[model samples]
Target chain A: MTPGHLRRDAALQTVLWIAVVVVANHLASAIPIRIDATGDQRFTLSQAAHDAVAHLERTLVVTAYFTADLDAPYHEHEAALRDTLDALAVAGAGRIDVQFVDPSTAERAEAAQRAGITPVTYTVRAWDRQEARSVFMGVHVGYGDRQMAVPALLSIPKMEVELVRAIRILTVDPEDRRKVALLQGHGEPNPADYPAQHPLYQLRARLGERYEVVQTVGDAPFDEDIAAVLTLAPTSPMPAATLWHLDQFLMGGGALGFFVASAQPDYQRGTTFEVRHGIGGFLGSYGLALGREVVLDRVHNEKITLPAPGGRSVQVDSPLALTTTHVERTAHAVRSLRSATFPFAAPVVVADPLPEGIQAEVWIRSGPESTARPGPIPLDPRLLVEPAASEVAGPHVLAAVATGTFPSFFQGQPPPGVRADEPLAKGRLGRLLVVGSGDAAANNVDFVLNSVEWLLEDPSLATIRARATGDGPMTPPPAETAWRWKIAVVAPQLLLGLALAWRVRRRRLA
Target chain B: MRNVRAILRRELIGSFGQPIALVALAVFLGAVALFTLWFDDVFVGGVASMRRPFAWMSVCLAVFAPAVTMRAVADERRTGTLHVLATMPVTSFQIIVAKWLAAVILVAIALGLTLTWPLALAWFGDLDPGPVLAGYLGLFLAGSAMAAVGVAASSSTESQVSAFLLAVVATGLPWLVGYALPLVPRPWLGVVNYLTFEYHFANLAVGVLDSRSIVFFASVTALGLRFATHALEQRRLA
Candidate 1:
């Protein structure tokens, strides 16, 4: 070939290559084909998530409210949420329309407020100064006239599961939804409050999505249609009549999700007080008891920011705030959960052998490297120190479930206010889920939600909602196994190097 | 195609025949394994993924790729072998492709050696092959782009040392630009990030097969090969 022909041919090949690449890129972006090789298939949408969005007969609109220009971790959460929404949009086949709304604007903020999406305040270091910025990271799903909102996307691991559950709630017929009675009037946070800082507001909103949640005060008769009753951190002792009512309700095969706190901490006062809500005798009779001591695990826990001597806040791991990834011994309700943190938790003990026809299972437990201290403990930062040798080690249960017929606490004699006409000899089949810490609901709402769904005998919702993305857990290998892994990682390269060296030596000799 | 294969076979043999090339390969593989095992602590992290090793592989290729490709064209010109090759019936494109393929194959072999990472992780814990496979794919593509840059650098220079330095700078420029991206204006940040090799490779490292990223690497390889071809033509004319 001539020089000019060679130049032209080379130029043509370059142009053709560029064109092919540009076209291929555009096509690939247009049609994304992903293979989720994760054990949980985290990247791929679960069948339940697909079915929830695919079966959308009416238009479902998902409005994501995320503040722009957030810090590192929050931005990652927003990106994951966006990716999940994109996946949902693909699975929805155009039935689901998603709009990302920046709630920094007044109009959008008001719209978010109307949809019950709240903004969380974060302390971010900006311009070399600590600044408190309120950022909105929430999602609202609307189907027809009904709507449901995830108040905060705090946990990215459960983001997809939350979106799927929200969509399922919005699509289902309201009347067919299960009913849960929230026992109130005991100084628990009101479920009707919508403030972002309110602890139980998000939990109530989430439960309201799938259940007709009714807040009933003392002496209020248990509704016949109610599938379960949720009593979260009841401060005051219930009246004898209400206690009898709860007993009768349990006798009638109703489920109970009790989130009782053994001690309540006063952060302002730097102190704690032992709480007696007067349900201990009832629980003990049912072969379950909440310890007066607080359980602390050094191995698996969360850190808290404490004011240092230098006037700057330093993060220190606290035994009071425990984070546990040990879910192996849990029931199906919490079996799929990767991790959960229980702040200010007490120990749940199986006090005695379960009665005949009764089955009890411990759902969550503290790690083996844990200690429990008698409560009314100080809430000072100094108390966050490492566990001493004197502290006890244990596998303390933090939450448990008991299911079966039971002889009531008032089996022999009725309470002072109870009527003799009430049946107490033989209780019907029932389930009682007892969680030792109310603060756990604040950290892991999934645990509370899963417990409720399990109590309602709806495993599908519990299992589907508990499914998370990524590998479930990677327990660190033993020391010997780690050494073996190191050997395995390094041996191949060494072998190759030796082989190359030998080949070179052989060639030189030849 | 036959001519290209023949040239490729000859290049492979020539590359393996050199003790320096073998030593470079050994050093590259050993460094990757050491960095992944000790510095990144894949075993301690218990991640059961090759992300750490692949990440290190990217940085390693920035150096090793240049070493391998510097001698591909520059040493041939230094030894007066290029003029002889030019007298052959095969075109310059075939010769360039053969050299490029040989470098890519070397990189693939290096990457294949790191498979023991995931295999070892699997022995101890559950290792996800999906992300590991994706990570290897990203590494291969990234290494090919680096190889193309090195070849282009080699074609532009007759001194092996100058070619190695130039290729290293070329491959390192994208990473430097990526690190400086946060300082860029917000409006142009997306475009700047898209131009970065790390940005594209990272998406694939996480098991995402984004077409835009693939396109970026492909474009880089093609541009480098085109530059090398032009350099050869200019030398021939001179």
Candidate 2:
């Protein structure tokens, strides 16, 4: 009860508290939190990290190359790195060791250069708001012999995906070569457009694990060396000869991932937003011609808006419409976009009549506000042309699945340069899918992953939204129309009266 | 009324004392930078930049609100301060209501600062304020409700670590439950998951701000506030 005792007691308490916090911080930081929200066969980053670490394939080393110096413009990039390293360390438990390397060092620079990794130079401006010069943000993730270089970790999107990929590359078998193709020729998105340093580019590096990836152009040799043909933005119109070759290739049942933006009219205007590409000749050949027009779905609009002709009156544009669906008749689907903009568009019309024995099932559609448009628009300077009232009309298909016996664009035989006879007898016994718009394929994988799952024959991945955008026909009969009363009485009466007056006028003239 | 003021002032004052509030503020700013610099190119797929900051601000709210609210009540209870407050004349309900209100106010301030994002975007290109407003409103409601869940989980626990983890679990449960249950074979999966907070939060995320989503979020906060009050009362009884 003495004063001396009280002072000592307080000091002891402070020391104990400090000790507890230090130990707690280390222990907690070590405990990797595994998130497995994706149920059934889905391995989240944490789980993947755990599995890789537990395997202890080798000394799985991970080096984080973010500069923690405050003076760096990329100082903003630190938190994500901190959180990610923390997460990785936790998942690795004791097996996977991580070192946060300040890649700004000469030794570090030399290490990165020697790793066969290019220094990802990002132009970082100063946070001071006065002098702005470019700085770089880069990170390396991997183990002893191999490592993955991540240029930057800014947006939290797919960091988990990237991390999982890195771990897989470090641990997986050497024989498992991933077959990926940046499909050649017809304006497919270039690999460079993947932002050579983007996480997607890293994804390509990881996929190089299990498949032989060939960036193929044109359909000629359909190389035996090629596993899948990745056609992003096919620049040249695929001649009918090419289509015939593709048809036969598909008949051989090779995995064909056509990320095509065949008729995205917005590209012509020097802007790429507000676009919906229609698979006209291709899908039309199948059974449906996804109207190559833009579709507007009020049900789901991106919570984005843009200015219209009259500055005061703003137009509601849905930029995030890819995944966010709003609940309204305008969107008229499983979800609606809360944001709106000129960028997100509907699928083009699937109007081409289906060839005999082909069945096309639409995997994704725009809201009731869909509109299809024609295009051969230039992709450079990406922009949607200034909209006319006519351009706004839509209800087009952006993506769909067509499966049947396909008629070869090259019906009878091979082309002049043909060498070996690739098999064509198995053409329509299986399914071939034509996506109206390829936007959902690249980048929007978070939302459109379900569509890819369905396309890949994973049938199990047909998960949500695929239950169907809705049941029953998308549109209703005239009788069920809310304005049916006006149509029944006013419209008919006016027409009849006008006809009668015209007759009377004719009789008078006689 | 006096009890609410005392609690609010204590919460507000406490938030300023530690570097926690400043850290959250800094993180918010960091998010703005990311939005301006990177998200434009990445998120919009190089098509058209968002040119507005609200959508990105909303994403920040999603990450930060849980971190802020996790320690709001749980830290108090863990440090034995909840017991001190419980002994005071203040009712548990007043305490819970005051804390929730303060958290929401703090989030709103964060969002207010983020509003400058659209202006920054506007300086460079055209922007429609309607979606920006809707996006802000969405961020506010979604953030408030998510923070309330954090507060609720915090009140129910004693350790800040557990509370932080639980807050994440609590806020994220809606996404997991809503998206996961639908994939289940159970017949009522749709209806059940639809009832989760995300089904409604997502609605507001895109700017619909449906009465149902509003009510649902309000009810969640109210329900958590009430439950927290009960937890405080239990402490008093003990």
Best by TM-score: 1
Docking class of 1: acceptable
Candidate 1 lDDT by residue in tens digits, A61-99 = 999988876663354577678888988899999998999
Using Cα atoms with residue i matched to residue i, what is each candidate's TM-score against the true structure?
A: 0.75, 0.45
Q: Give chain B TM-scores in order.
A: 0.95, 0.84
Q: Model 2 chain A: which ten-residue window has the lowest total lDDT?
A: A467-476
Q: Report residue B7 deviation for candidate 2 (angstroms).
A: 17
- Native contacts recovered, each model: 0.33, 0.00
Candidate 2: Cα lDDT at A268: 25
- Please give the CA lDDT of all the candidate structures: 0.77, 0.52
- Per-residue lDDT, model 1, residue A388, is 52
DockQ of each: 0.35, 0.03
Candidate 1, position A25, lDDT: 64
* Cα distance off (Å), candidate 2, residue A190: 6.3
Best by lDDT: 1
lDDT of 2 by residue, A271-341 (tens): 33433222355545546554444443433444333334555434343422333221122212212122222
